[model samples]
Target: MFDRRSFLGSAAVAGGLLPLPEALSAQALAPVPLPPPDLYGKNEDAYWAALRRQFLIPADVVNLNVGTVGSSPRPVLKAIFDGFEQTEQMTQAGSEDYPIWGYGSWDDYRKPFADFMGAQVDQMAILRNCTEANSYIANGFDMKAGDEVLISDEEHGSGEMPWMLRQRRYGMVVKKFAMPKPPKSPADILNRINDAITPRTKIFFVSHISTATGVVLPIKDIAALARSKGIVSAVDGAHAPGMMKVDLNDLGCDLYTGSMHKWLFATKGTGFLYLRDEAIMDRVWNTIATGGYDDPTRKADRYMQIGSSCIPTLMGLNAAVAFANAIGIDRIEKRNRMLADHIHAEMMKRGAESWTSPDPALRCAIATVNVPPVQRMELQDWLWKNHKVRIRGGNPSRLRLATPYFLSKSDIDRFLGLFDAFRKMKGVA
Candidate 1:
């Protein structure tokens, strides 16, 4: 219902050029409702079809690249647009009150997401993005020049680069452990991590889900191992929150960082840094300082003092959380795994070797495969330009397919069919 005319009209009004039509404005801001509860009991496929209507992605275009980013559903978009309208009016009861997000403890916005992530409001700091949170961990955590931070070899650039930058500038040691190409069990990963640790190991920083192969690491075991050794455990959970259920307390990690924009389908700039307690918080200096940056009484809120930021984005984040809650994360996770397993099985049948974990518990929505004798860039361009199908992968072979709950099995089938057609065309079938 978001038309070009209404968008332009709103922009014009913001510029003091013209008044927006009341009906158009109302239509633009209206919330998209979830499918009725009874629909799920009647026809599960139809229920998912109804839920799929909530997304703005065109019916013809299929997006399998949610690992890189996600399309926010209509309800979250509505909340952001509505928030901007309400906040831009600039009429406040308190003379000191402002619309910016980074100044004070905005418990109203923080508490809902905190509860969703299984953490207290005092332990969560609303940050701009996962990269910023990772940078904060690397640049702010107390470490001696020769101290080591052990990480997996398959970390995302954002997760790895910050530590690399720190190492280059401060002379800290960055250590790496190779992950099994397709780990058959949790012990395969755990043993590598254990062997990599030494006396100088100050931190065990790894991803909850591997960004490269889409493998879910054994985080609880990793956290326990770190705790036993008195090494700080930090997780780059950028892809975990919406893909599966996350409980920070249960995971028992000292620190965690993630982005809501990727899988949670929240606003683009929303992310968080979670500190377990005051002891961990004290070890990290504020990366971006303001008035309350050094205040211990503020708890995790003190880290959020990074000057002015967008409040409408946080509003969208809350709406995203509500949207997931309405559908129930358990149901969403099940659907995600089913779709991923389906795709993985189909790709295996096509002689594509699995890069994702063989263990179901070690893999979730993302299903990675290595298809040799076919150039990935060539196939990637062909699928997108010709078939309107989008996928992401590395050169030579690897394909990382992300299955959001919104995608139907038929969508995966279409991609599979296209893959067959492409292979046949190239004489690689």
Candidate 2:
């Protein structure tokens, strides 16, 4: 299958560079034990059962917080290592192999990436990370000193940083839209955004899923409203790609960016950015200064990769998407929701309430359970120090559980059991 000579020839021509991980060894991994077939069934519950077979998770920890980061399967990880090893081997031999890009052309990655996102291939740009992707949109927009850019408090640092930098440096107006704690309805949330809008509002920036408190926005309606107001919509979907089913067309946003490493289970340092069309994206400067500035078609690639980067990661990143496609994104999504529902139900049974997301339809794989500010801080220390369950600690009386598709119901049950035990031990019960 791997015509080593042909691929090596191509790699030499592209750029004499080899990947990391030193190539496959003679010894291979032993057969992995899978979950019981019956545990995963017809619905989301069943899908979870099937999905758990794919992951190679450590037995000691209950990793319900895939919301923050996810692990790719053995195949993807192996590919990543192969890329590194190949590159390193070539380098050691006083030769170089292909560059960071796998396809002869950038469109090879774009088409499949766009297909996954439900966007036209031409509109998508593969980026290094979510920070780079969001910065491209944030700093690239055509704006004046007083031009209004509306953003939510719930946004990640990636969305908030660039605009904040722009406001101070360039004198742009950054408007903060206030969302209700427990939003009455999607309309109520929209009203908050609408109320902030004025004639000068040129940009509407929000996250499809918030990384901090885990609030999932109704981006479709919000995007539609932004369209009516002639505003450019940019979403920080760092938590959406692998955690949920994200169709860019359905969301109706002008621009969307997400991290592959965080949720897609791709290797670290890969991300995606989509511009509705080329015409709108021209506002951003091409990060590459050496070449391709004159060629409009090549601008996207040049912008995504500025200089020498980890090509091995890209190869593995590509394989990660292929794996996701093979498994079915919808099936992955349904199970993530089912797992979140499991966590939510169990937390409620233990007498803990939430300041987290409520709209089940909008929520993806993440859910936050607050155990009263003081209670959470102490319990959080206890869980990690005394107990082995790994989770994200919080400041706002919450613990965020970003369940990956691979985590099992029994795992969730175990986490619940821990919480209930913790509650009784802490005297909450």
Candidate 3:
């Protein structure tokens, strides 16, 4: 039985703050019904434009950097504020006197978020961020000193650092394989990864989508291969959950971790981890053990047993998932991809060479282009300073444009016009 008094004492208000919403019970704080999105609309732009209104983005700033982080929409913001008030109020009222009953636990957000990601409810954990989730998997797995781990050169630091740390601590061998700039096909990706695997390989670590090149790797095939080889597989999927359809069971990875804030437009510091086999929960040692560590019934949630977290952020994450659900993932995927494709075509017309793969199968909502005429940093600064258009420009000297569902075709067109002017200014031959 939960000690109601202890829970309330731990959750008390800080700095003489006002009480949060006392009605933190499931029934009292039930999610509000979202407005129906009209699927029958013929004007796609108009419909998308209306949807864009729900966000608090300034009219003058065009954000093509959702791949880095997304701005939470109005509904999610409202939920955060409401959750804060409710939690404080509940703490003030004391668990004995409060009308509602049950653990107003962060775990309440788990199932709905799990459903959103096409994962089992019992297999999910409310982690701090993608990095934390990845770290949990890296440190938890029992690997021998000489065990081998294979990963791509394109992986983000978060994906690579954990293995590197393990290598330093455990003498694990880490190998980096080269991936084609524009992959030939799915087989091509699979073959490259397969060719790299050796008898000593214990784990195959890769990204669902490479943030640098914005290329969608063949995660399903890779995961299946790992299972056949008796090797553990983990996917650094920080970009996939909301930007695309992420069916973890279908993907078949032993572990998959991602951030809700990136494409999901959830509050910052919200992320999750999905473990395919619930039994493996005990094998992976908890990095930070807390109350739920010893309970076998806790399942995958044992990884999330950190002491004291922001309750409102977890509630905000639920709202973010609800917001995305209202739009429908399939529809969101299509709209976002269409925008990226449009940008890809326009960049090609401007004599820009794409760093991202040309194959539709290998590319999704993120498009990276190398504009040779002007320096990438110069172009990025010009766009942000002159046009207030925010896109990512980084290593390998390429500009990454993230086509979110909220972005319109007109916005991409405007970006293209500015890009062309920059090319002309540079006197491209």
Candidate 4:
């Protein structure tokens, strides 16, 4: 075990990623100092390295809660602001000159994005965040008071609210079931859903990855089962799109929603929703309409594409998707997992139990550590304010960590070092 005394005095913990580059020596690593909060424009890797460079985390402020949000990459940020400024300039140049809705604008966003996620261009729709994506289906569902919907405890408010909101107004019953602890097998989780599902169950809602638990659910199997039962399966894919492998068409779920901002590395407020050609096309009616809202059948498109968005961010999403594909999804997933495993291993070495999933197959780049006796906020403040290390945290009084594709094993080692230091300070045996 990575015992307490050894944890504090260990030379292994010396720098603790302070000059994270030291630990990154073995890899093609580049540690950037994070930009001062005031500045949000820079794309050069070296500039980015400096920006991500100094994280003063000391358990007092490790932001491990990435399920809620992720920091934008330097390039993505630069692209967004640059695009924003360019638009401002274009608008100043005059309306006719600044043709906003050319048939080409949204189409440029199509093929590349579809290629990245392994879906056909027409099947993917550029929507905002997971909430909006899922809501499209949730609000459009053809339901009656007697119908039932199945969801897991891991469902976020976005996934849960629409159903509940409908329940109050529509009288549909929202049945939430708990997933198996550690979710050892797909069958283990499916059985729970199977039990709660009755003839009344018309739809199944699942999170591709539970934001609350860093646990990756087996959507394929569950989705197949839902299909077998003649129920529609809609997935809350907020964490999966950017964090791991997701081919919407192949996954076979009825509908899917995702946030491009998280693992997708797109600018914030950009995301997409996908519908199986058979699942949503023409079956759901548009609840809202605006100008040119002639056909209620084609209204789903208008429902989502309403109001203008960050033109550059949406364009950059296409770029981010292309970048992810060029890098290879499997490669990024492997790198992210390796860093997470490193952190888990070191925490285990120190004899600290993980509050998150331990099974690698059931987990992802995100993980949470249970910190005994110490207040989470207190620990977070100390680590970030004193040690200069950065980690994410949230409720349940634990540390949640997400290793993006950009992180490496040495980065993991650095995090472990700080964890070791903290354990020692707490006098953990």
Give per-candidate clash totals. Answer: 0, 21, 7, 43
Residues 1-429 of candidate 2: C-alpha lDDT, one tens digit per residue? 344445555665679555422242211222334445444454655655555555666566777667667877766766775777676554543234445452223675667767877888767777778998888777778899999999988788888999999899899999998766656467867999999999999989998887766778889999999999888888998988766777898788888888998778888888878877666667666544444444567635546545556667777777788877876788678877887877876776666665455667656677777677336666666777786677775775677887777787777787777877876776764
TM-score ranking, high to low: 1, 3, 2, 4
Top TM-score model: 1
Q: RMSD, each candidate, Å?
A: 2.9, 6.2, 6.5, 11.5
Off by over 4 Å in 4: 1-65, 91-105, 292-300
TM-score of each: 0.95, 0.85, 0.88, 0.79
What local distance difference test score does each model get? 0.92, 0.73, 0.81, 0.67
Model 4 TM = 0.79
Model 3 reaches what TM-score against the true structure? Answer: 0.88
Candidate 3 — which residues are off by over 4 angstroms? Answer: 1-36, 92-105
Residue-level lDDT tens digits of model 1 in 234-347: 999999888899999899999999999988999999989999999999999988899999999999999999999988999999999999999888988999999999999999
| Model 1 misplaced regions, further than 4 Å | 1-31
What's the CA RMSD of model 2 in angstroms? 6.2
Candidate 1 lDDT at 337 equals: 94
